[model samples]
Target: MKNINNIFLYSALFLSFSVFAQQGKQKKADTLFNKFSFVKASKVYQELIQNNYNKDYATRKIADCYALLRDPRNANRYYKSVVKQENVPVEYYYKYAQSLRGMKKYKESEIWLQRYIDSGGAPGNNDFTKNVNFISSVFGAKQQYFLDKVRFNSKFSDFGAFEHDGKVYFASSRDEGVSTKRLYGWNAQPFLDIYVAKAGTRKNVDHTAKVPGEINSIYHDGPVTITKDGKTMYFSRNNFTKGFEIKDNKGLTNMKIYRAHLVDGSWTNIEDLPINGDDFSTQHAALNSDDSKLYFTSDRPGTYGGSDIWVANINEDGSITDVENMGNLVNTQSAEGFPFINAEGVLFFSSDGHIGLGLMDIFATIKGDDNAIVDIINLGIPINSSTDDFAFTMNPNGVTGYFASNRRGGRGSDDIYAFHREPVLHVEGVVTNAINMTPIEHTKITLYDENDKEIAFMHTDENGYYQINIDRNKDYKIVASQNKYIEDYRKFTSKNLQTELITIPTNLLLNPVHDVAKLAELKDIYFDYDSHEIREDAAKELLKIIYLMLYDYPDMVIKIESHTDSRGSLSYNDKLSIDRANATYNYLIRGGIDPSRITAHEGFGSRQLTNGCESDTDCEEADHQLNRRTHFTVVQME
Candidate 1:
């Protein structure tokens, strides 16, 4: 019964607003129509004309607002309206034509644009008209425009998109929630849980939630952030387990900031934020542009409104210092929630209190000293509809941004949507053989970080093509290899690699290793001078030799031979190289090789490598590596 009255009240309010609008009278409304308020202001001008008032300037003001607002819908409406009521300003008619062109009424817009130029419309004022003409002439309407939609089945609504260490961290109210039971006292749902998933997985949906079992009790447990190493997770969980003082009458566990350490890839020992904190709801967290400080929303005391956005200093220990309310420029008497700081230090938050297009649309303003805002900007349509759109978080590079929306045609209640920040990098390329430029099949393309861990890997199809989706300023290595080809390695240097339609195509020429013996030429055996003590390098070579012999001829037993130069006495050389062979034999025995399959050493002494010994004065060190050697020749075939 009481809900009926509230619905009636909203309906009446909407009707009243449609019936009347006063020009520049509302204090806050005048403030928000900042630069583009021309559309609403133009409506007021139209009202004055309807009232039979002498307001020729108001008509032009309407056109000006439409021009600045960039809304072809209303821009065309008032453009025609102003011309019908008054002689279209020779200067304004070109803008009207531009508006028409924006609406795709190109023929009509073109006719008016000509008259506008003939009537002495200045080039500067008609810049918008010229841009419209270029769009129609140069790039036709059929030019591709894409709308990327993310559809996923979520247990609970998802929000707070953060990418750390190449994986996406987000908060989801899912069936796999931390709390299986709901809270009866506050009538709160047990859905708000934290979840993580691979960022760009388009196949079979995986909604596996990775929340610590202990911290995610039967309460609100999410809206989380993860450290770069994924070792520390900072999340907002309701109620303290030890029972700290909670000022909010709702519930003690309703809102609090908590941190937990990730040991062995699992979260442990959850703790609450210490400084600049209260029992009140300290929820809705946002990291600063540098991620040095965190901005969160709370309805605690000392705030001018229902909820105030506060900034807290982030400590190395994951503790935060006394939080300061962003002040009047950032907060208002109305609910101000969901703070987001972009790379430019511009502050973005959502509020119905601030004069805006609708309830809960995002707004941006330069954060100034004394909490004063400079040039507050309202996010335009689609991004900002008459519905709730909040909880925006972007990665460090700022090329791709994410926001939560229940907007429509989604898999679940409130699935998260990702968007390309204008000028996002769309990196695409191809891989080919360096020699012939022909497509190489089955070539593996792996992308790795500085730590040499593979982030993504793929095999080239018949065309030998590979594409990588990457952010800006990150160092990455592209290694391309095929079954028999030497790997083709290349590196893409860091530049302004941030754009949505970026095309950086390259070829990966993989050189095939046709020379089989040249493979791993580093595999060598070396011996000590005048001694048969098998060096560790030589031992390793013998080990490989044993492995290959066993692999290729499973039933073969071979004798290992060690040789020395003529400088040594035959008897001395015999014992020296024999001990060398025996040392290698011992190594093989220690390596789990069969003792039964072995034969003793055969050292031929100085006769083995005395190719020039009969007349030689001396031999270089290079000859030494060759002279002191170990070899395996198959002796007995089992």
Candidate 2:
């Protein structure tokens, strides 16, 4: 019995020791994760899961690690384990949805995304849920860009291409041949440095070399923009500069934008920008066309997300002021950074917050007439992928450019890729009435391809103007229609088109149905003296209207008005005119016209005389005969 008790005691001691050891390991893994060391933390979390110690928490952490590392395949695998577990946080559902999207499982991603939304996961001001068909629309769009990986890419991260003076400048994590190699803990990669090479489209040439300057440090650096004169430079670097490092309260070093001057063909005079903060990151500097404004990414106080695009006015003395956020239209509740402003002032940036195919997708800003950002358009496919795609830089020609992506088949974790943009085709015109030449507002415009398949549709603006993007070298049909008007169908071909934009010179004209109904020339039906019955001549005139309403315009509606000559007392004439109008209404109904088509049948009682036929006045008998008649007027036509 004593031996059995001893065995129990030994077992308990061993169990207690194991629990303490596991707790210690969990604490260590959490510390590493907090420090942004996802690669190391992931391994530790996997070990904890193998020991079955706090398996749920460890599983979630492992998934989070893979997600931060942009490894959606592994993240999806691990997230599947805990997403269905009891009491799991709702955010895991959102993360799992993102991972599925990274794998191009868009339908499955939508299901999990719906579940996340149903579970009360707040997505802020983004309209992902509102636009349920956005994914389909994105995939349905034409391919805009063709990409080719640059040959200089190493087996490490090589991205952020910027062009100046016929040379391509970029950032890379390749070995620098320093005696003591320093590495970033996030992905176990070497510190980033600036490199330069001759700018060309050739795939076999590799003339990459480090920038000839003291710009590099033991920490992260590079990804730069130079002024039009090639005298001033702005770049991103770790907070460590001037032989010291600045860290936030969490002991994490943030990024900062620095300025440098080019002297005698070498970059020097390095200085950090005043907009940077020790507690937050401010990097990825870009300049507008005129160099009067500087654009950059920052996570300072007023940001709507992890980071947001910010603009500052450039002073005459190479300083910045009047910093402003780009607003919610360009930023969301997730990360947005790497802004690149083109010559036309179009803002291109990368975001994980907006609706995208996966982790980080590139987007372009659509500005209003006031130059405020009104909307954002996804750059869709080839330019973006299921992984991080950012640091887009466009050349002056606008057709050819470079961007970076960590997508599949890359030579490294991230690679710089040259891209050629295909020319886009657009058809624009105004819709107007054929008879009166008046602009027809709210006309429905539909576009159909050669296969007669409806491709897109929209309503014309208040000014009767419409514009639609079409595919090059394809036959298309545009149909414009409005209420009470005949539809106008115009077929055109974009085949062999050389220009990007074409304005249809001829306005789309819709003929009003009322104009066509006028062919009936509805003559008045006269009545004999003191008679409220229809004559043969009256029946002949009524048949014209009946035939048109039944065979020509079945949806037409009309009203009947009857008048009497001034021969009897006012009350008698009024009663007689009403009976005449009612007779006409009944005749039309009996002739197979829908009763609802007759909007009204009323008597004027000699109030609307066609001539001076009052009882006190001497007028011709023909004028009196004209007064005793029933008239038809079209009220509505569909």
Candidate 3:
């Protein structure tokens, strides 16, 4: 009796163990399929189907895997099968919706998108936002202006978009990106890819996903963008490729950027991006809003971390210039990449090093007047998250932008999404002369992008003030030049400085060399405020005059005069102006102008207005400004 009882117990234990083993194998198969390792995972799922086990999870995962592997036909087929099974979770609906979109079944895809949203699935991750706007953009060349809101949102993550002719053309890998296959693993799903959609409008959910095919290849493929002329396509790809794959000394794979020129209306030949074959990885390319410059990301040497964004010029020959490090201010110790240059010179990039809500977040930086690159500002919370978020592409129009994020949930490893918003650029400043407090009249200023190409030129009015109208997504070099002065310069890096940023001071203190030489015209001697003091400005002018005297004649001497406008009494004005002239004499003495050979002090109160110019009573302020002036002839130079 004891032996028979033991046998019955053993039989029961064996049955339980068998069931558990079958479930483990089934779960493992589901995981493999979700990881984008479809080739092997498919075999497991097929076994489950043959063995007649619970195939719902396995079925859904297989469909998602096919989509990630860029095999739309199979993915679409399986996704349909999951829906037919009925009572599918909202996530399953989302995957099926994407699968249909991949097949260009816009109507069906949009229906599923609606269903998913209606089923308590929120927006903000990969498929986080509405799809109406993206759908409309797919049929045209312009879309970026509509996607800015999604890109600029403080908490949303977006990327993988394309832009053209003032339009945004890109994608976002956000919401629901944390699938079982990507996070915390060795064999993670390399699931980013190329997708095209319109910006700003109510994007159709059916417009959200596509077949990918040659466009999305393996791993990741976009924020796909074309030059304004629409002659070339620029985009980013991840750790692996379809054909060319190389290993470094460390045995690690790096991302590479590629470009294809639109020849006769079709992208004819694709080539690797120049400067992208460095030891590190590189991706994402954005041309300046004006089409004069190009920006991108790379983990090349000199970067702050995993991948700091770098920029280079798109030369007239269509080649890139040597890469310039954006520096500590814009890049942090973590990964910082994906830079977008707006027309107004404010640059946007992604970084994980600086303070941010995620592993990587977007940042902005402003350029200075000296043509120097400044640090980047980590775009805070609204657009960031505790997850990995990056890849931003922008256009000046109020339409679109591309960004990426890995948030709560999504179909594949990371699916690309789309959207739109307004564009922005900022610039402001003040202008003054180099030697004196006096305002410079009609100071001409020219603005150039980082590539040294001219963007704007203006003249300072009587107030000696000028301001630049900055277009977002542009870089500029403000070159201030006048007929008698050396060039004064200001640099707007386009990353940090924006609207109402500190008023850029237009103080033109160009070297006095040009105006002080023998052949050079001596504009005038200048003095400090109210005190008639021979200030540093005065000294700078005197040095120039002294040098001219020495060069023209080894020994020369002269007198200096101080004049005042008709604002004071005769005795007081006369004595005051004399002392002012004497101050000039003392300044020259200290400036190596031999005192023995020079004499100073003499004031003609309100007496000197140039001939032919109107009198102070009837003339423009020019006459009075000239009246209250300082003058000095060639003093002794021994």
Candidate 4:
């Protein structure tokens, strides 16, 4: 009886100790997670899961950690287990959907997205649910940017490229020569620090060095913005002051934006902005064009989501006031941050909440005349991928700039990329009659490359206006043709242009082909020197006669006459002119004009010089070329 009692007591003691240890581990894991130390928290949760203690809660926590770390593959795996449980949180479905999308499993993603909606998740929160063809639309968006990874990126998460005073500033976790190499538990990388490099044009960077100032801290620092005068600076950092961290009641140190002044070329006197709070984070500071208003990302009170963009007016005395949230047009029920407003008052930010390709895609705001955000536009591919992309900044010109992304094939977990906005090359114009300046409706306008290959074609509207998009840095020829009219040709080049939208005003004027007298007054169709082959310029003129004969007057009969300059021998010139006439006749035959419509073809050679340039030396080269011409006369119209 004594041995039995002893055995029972020992077993009871051991069971109590095991339960106590498990409870302690759970408390520690919860604390780490609440503090945003996801990496450390995830390990603790996994240990609990392996021991079969609080398996459900640990599993869900691990999934959340992976999601925050942007490890979508691992997140998807863990979330699979989480969603199979009974009475799962509605957010789990949304998160699972996002993880699936990050893996490009779009179909499965859509199913979970629907589940989220069915489980009382707000449809407005999921942009994918609003548009039925959202995926296809995002993939089919035109690529308007060219991206290249910056050369100065380190192997340890470098991002947030900003420009100030001829230097490029960015945040990095590189700890090659730093004194304190403390790593963040969230990523296992060293805390971010601000670094500067000499800026070069279009994605070039020189030697990089740490900013020689007291701005960087032992905790997270950097991703900064400066005023245009280079005096005032705002940067994100941990809520630490005087070598000690300040924490909220939950013992979490939130991010805060600090302001510093440039005195004698070194930043000093750093102070936290008034809008910072002890509980929620307020970081990623940006300024409007004139520095009159400061914009930043925050999760403070009145936020509609995990984070939202907020603005505050910068008073004349350097005090910030009138804090306002940037409404639903710019915010959603997901993380949104890294706001950058260009000189043109255009807002560019990053969000996973908006309809996008996948995980945090860059977005731009479309504002009304009153400067209110009316719509949000996703800046599709190259600027955004299936992973996190944010921290977009543009130069004053707005054509070339830099942004950060964590997509595959980067030097770091998150790398900064330089991008150049491809110019929207287009030519728009009105087609009008040369004689009366009247709009010529139904004229077919065609665009050809330098090689005379037809690339695009359109017809003039009722108002005689036409527009055609063309490739950049190439020569293009545009032809406007209509029945009963002479074709008008215009040639232009889009080389050495840097504007985002290059609109070339190309007004075409066509002459009416009323009668033989009107046709005779048309510009001479000149041929190349010493060649009887039809030149491109001559072919354009020949097309007009073809159109008139084939479409305008099907029963019209025309006579062709060719002439040559005086440089060639009379017999050779006569033979060359006859060959030119034959070439014109063949061209018309191929253009769908009936062969019976031709009345006669002849060669006048040098005998029909339109100018006094009987010899090459008598006039300029242009005048001599005028004699080498072809003329079409309407013999009969029915």
Candidate 5:
């Protein structure tokens, strides 16, 4: 009887072991699913579903895997089982909607999207309304951009297109003859590396060559941004630097931004950026045309969501400081990345948080005068789709640009697409001295768009010539400044009048600083309530005076008469006015004007009032503002 009982126990134990072995296989599937290796993960998930092991989870994952793999037919088949399943997450509804859309089932997609909103998904967030509007916008609006896939796409993921020095640079996972190429388990693709090729038009492209060892690494290395001069390069890479590695939570190495100098036709002097931290990731480095500010994506602390776009001020010494978040207007409770600022200050980035067609969509926003995000709107269809679309960039001409999209009908996982817009506007002109009418070489010319936002700035070539791209149906302000001359300002608009490119040529004739008081009336220099610091606009005006003393009229001498409104005691006003005058004097010296050029900075203490805003009487703020003025007079010019 004891032997028979033992035999029964052994049989039960064997059955339990068999069940545990099957569960292990399911766990492995979950691992793969988490890593987004859907191609491999779906096999195990489907097997588990067939065997009725965790059938609900397995079914949902199988559907999701197919959706991510862009196999909408299979995704639709599998999703049908869980789209209406009980207690599923709201994201399932969104995913189901996208899969339906990809399968060309618009009605079904809208139904799922409505269900998702009704289930309290992304409520109170413009998300629901944006998605619904996107449907109508896609069909109602005319497509403004035509996209064509480039010729260099391999059968693997390729993206992050940028153009520099007449060469096309991008990131790719193609086998680039690197023996050390290792597969990233996350997607089972080779690690990304930077590649360069000859510049090509939309129709033709040359084969690519891998960057040198100085830039490429054993790990991911690319998606680089080069300065307008192509001398400095900023790129993204893992934290493996100088034999050290930085890792974040879960022991995963995070990405960091690095800078390289173009030394003797090769990239050298690689250094990790100061904004990078080991605890998070920083990638996608982009620069404004001037290279004074670097914009990038990071998952660092203080981010609004999984990631946010941030900018760092690049100092004259080549060090970066003052990292700033792009703020709530641009970032949201989801990820935002791949920021590209065109020659115009308009910012273009990809975000999953904002209302969009699908998983991720491209959006554009203009920076406020304070350098903060002011407005944001989706780029709409063709430029955006029901899948990931990012890495947007434009040529200096603005009309021609490239972006990466993983939407259906792509040649690879992610392919670079060239886009062209019609009715392009171009601005070309020259800068010259107003007195002599001679070309002013190296003069700085700045262009501002309708919103009074800077689009771009450039130093005039040898002939004081410059050309830039501008958008039609918008107002623009062009300012020209050169050493030894007063800045020139002009305002104009492009009405999209012609089919071909329209060139608006306006030559700038800058005046000498000593002649600013004669040529253009100097405006009142305003300060914060009680602070003596000069305002930004005021500083720009003051630079005109500095230019005269320092460059144009090196022997010029000037006297400053600072005045204040009669709001305080006479003694207090006198001291305050003196402080203001000293502040302006310091500004000129700091701006490189010789101290000896200034004869005197007298504080009038409200004695010289432009209007009657006396301390003893009630007056409007505007009246007081007029009284607070700094008058400049040329004492001598040689």
Candidate 6:
């Protein structure tokens, strides 16, 4: 899952073997391997394997070499041969899994993942166990994105997409000139260089041009970050100056962050960051939303892992201070880098340590109210793969974003992909009382899908309002409940609309069963023609009465009053309306409303008509329908 930054290929340490008696050729191969010359080391190791001398160790070493070179084909072949051996390290299983993933063998990769876990890899990390299940769930989830290759991608590695000031800036290894053609040993690709292109539709994107000569160095210089105003810029480059490279204790030159100021429509006054160090790398710089803290990936001392995300405070004078590791919440024993924080404070980064679908899956971390990382969620499929998927950036809206990956179907090595998240509908509303329309605070609300399956739950705030996200083209049943009030229910649907935001004006008005007149305020329940059964629409309204009597005031008594129109004969109307009232009483009892609470069932035969139509059609159909209705009143409180 390592980003193939060829300029600093020495950062990847070669695997060591136990010293033993060997021939001259084997000794020379070990020498090359120790010097971190994986390309030469692999050749010698292969020769030993061909001769059946030190076959086991040589096979392992060659596999490691191919892996270091990012050659998945050879790595997979060699790993498959020896990975099943009992003496093989647990890491071999992981490497084999990554290799399979690189080849788009997802199911086979999953088998190796199980082997890695069974071999005690990352013991006691429950997140690793959950990650296996999370990957499966991700594949079955509704597709949330539509991906397309970015137009500016080159045949070489092109990634790290960022937008600022009407231009898109990214890192590319595309050839510029013969002078800038130094090759990186890892993938044998030219060193990365920052390129700026007009940011627009594919048809209008200007051919990408290299940045000013001051920014483009012979070594790696790319993956830039800009302030909100697009004035200040920070980019990654090898720690070299004046035609000489800075080497650490391991004889490896590390990457460093550099600052550049925008002046007169060009980047000028370029300088190295104050935090640069020779012992470790500090690259992939990013600024928080308010520019208060600068976030970057570093392999410095005191790191909890190979590479950790560190943050430094940006003071008023623009000097950085108080650099601290983001801690284990974001870092692990494995490499984690390419940190990007959006305006919403959600941190997105790539990691191999966290259990993921593949090698380096992108993860999102959101902090809780206490500023602790509440959840570290893997951004699953299409955004992540078994291959290296890092260097993610997005616009303010978050509907569209870009990330780089070496997964299959790419235009070339590590192609940059543009993706847009499908719109997720938001449901927002206020919970208020029906009588005085007063805000109901702290009301528990549960959201369920059409099949009555619960989706999510929340409590109404002090302002009597709540909001939650729901999927589009789905029907939801929202149930609002409070201890002292009658519960309310609403049926809502997203209806296949792809709008950015959708608000449902659901106001739950609960009538207290203690007040008889207030209970009567509920709309009259109507029955079908010549039938006493509660229709579907009328049953929904009846749920309020049932909830009030059963939940709010279990012992409170209520009377069911069924009225009949003036059309039927007096005796028949009386008998029919009585049966109708009894039917409603039975429905409530079946719904778990206490039958004891229903104190009375009475039918009035055409006696309480407001239209005053006696045995004649003097009133319109609307008036007659109103006369044939059911009403409930509280007969007792407490």
Q: What lDDT tens digits, residue by residue, belong to model 1 across residues 179-280?
A: 345543542434466666667656433335555445555456677776555666778876656555355454344477777788766777877676325446
* Candidate 2 error regions (>4 Å): 1-140, 201-208, 424-638
| 3 versus 6: better TM-score goes to | 6
Task: Please identify which of the two predictions, 1 or 4, would achieve the higher lDDT against the true structure.
Answer: 4
Give TM per candidate.
0.44, 0.47, 0.38, 0.52, 0.46, 0.49
Which scores greater on lDDT, model 3 or model 6?
6
Poorly placed runs, candidate 5 (over 4 Å): 1-140, 201-208, 367-372, 424-638
Worst 10 residues of 1 by lDDT: 135-144
Per-residue lDDT over 90-185 for candidate 6, one digit per residue giving the tens place of the 0 to 100 score: 767777776777677878978887887887765333232343432223222235567865777767888898887778888888774555368988
Locate the minimum summed-lDDT window of 10 residues in model 3: 135-144
The deviation in Å at residue 393 for candidate 5 is: 0.7
lDDT per residue, candidate 3, 27-142, as tens digits? Answer: 56643432223455666876766655445656765665455445567877987898776555566667677667767787988898788778886644434233422211111111
Total residue pair clashes for candidate 3: 105
Candidate structures ordered by lDDT, highest first: 2, 4, 5, 6, 1, 3
Residue pairs that clash (backbone atoms under 3 angstroms), model 6: none
lDDT of 2 by residue, 560-613 (tens): 999999988889999999999999998887777888999999998888888878
**Model 6 TM-score on a 0 to 1 scale:** 0.49
The best-first sequence of candidates by TM-score reads: 4, 6, 2, 5, 1, 3
Cα distance off (Å), candidate 6, residue 140: 8.1
